[model samples]
Target: MQRFLPLIIVLVLVGVFLRMMTLEGRNPNEIKSVLIGKPVPEFTLPGLLEEEADLTNAYFNREEPVLVNFFASWCVPCRAEHENLMKLAQEHGVTIVGVAYKDRHADALEFLDELGNPFSRTALDRNGRLAIDFGVTGVPETFVVDADGIITYRHWGPVVGDGLEKAILPALEEAR
Candidate 1:
């Protein structure tokens, strides 16, 4: 019994060490970028306006560069970023698409109405499948896809006021 006690203690210590190492090395903020310089993933979701609006076909047409933003009514950061999106739509001629991540259609509509709808089109990702395809970890993630349908830049977390002028606009210009 004494010999086994020592072995158990050693095993527990090793487990603790491993867990500590993993926690120290892993960064929650360090989200990996995907589809960079590649064609964006093809997906179809319901538009926010209609129960059956075809978002997939509309997105695939290369009329202009597209900004796809993953957001939810429940996300505070999304509300924080909403104004920036609205400004981009109104001022910059930038087409913005919203994906209502894991949210109900009615709630998403209410959020848009309350915040001012900036999105040229809003897609319903009721199950988060499209969000997963886009490598979204959480709400308020944004992706910029060029007119040629290539994904150029991805921003994790909320798109702050400065982020639009600094990062998003430049990428859109380059893609154009």
Candidate 2:
């Protein structure tokens, strides 16, 4: 029994060490940056326009830069960032595209109508595959893609006040 006691202790210690190591290296908010200096992921989603516009083809191929915002009608932070996006879209000539993350089409349309449709094109990501491809762990994430479809900047959480001009715009300008 005495000899076996040390073996059990060693096994338990090994298990604890492995668990601790896993936790130490784990980052809950970690998102991979795939769009940085790379072509935007190809996605052709249905738009909110009357003509059912294609977002990836129409916007990515354009000569001007574009902003892509991932949001959901159920996300509260998205509401907080709505005004800032609206102002940015109106003031700057930056093209703004919205992806409704894992939401019903009707709810997304209603949310836009109530909050003000600031997006040039709004796409419904009902299955959340696009959001996952973009490495989005939460809503209200924004990405700035240059004219060449290269992702220039990414912002997580609610963007407010000078965040648009201060952080996002500078990156867009640099990419330009």
Per-candidate Cα lDDT values, in order, are: 0.85, 0.82
Runs in model 2 with CA error above 4 Å? 1-32
Q: Write candidate 2's Cα lDDT for 1-176 as tens digits.
A: 99899999999999988786678645446565766777788777877656666666446766778889999999999999999888888887667889999999889989998999888888988898888778787998998888877788788778887887777888768767
Clashing pairs in 2: none
Error of 1 at 32 (Å): 2.5
User: What would the TM-scores of all predictions be?
Assistant: 0.80, 0.78
Model 1 score (lDDT): 0.85
Any runs in candidate 1 off by more than 4 Å, and if so which?
1-28
Tens digits of per-residue lDDT, candidate 1, 62-109, equal: 968899899999999999999999899999878988899999989999
Q: Candidate 2: TM-score?
A: 0.78
In Å, residue 165's CA in model 2 sits off its true spot by: 2.7
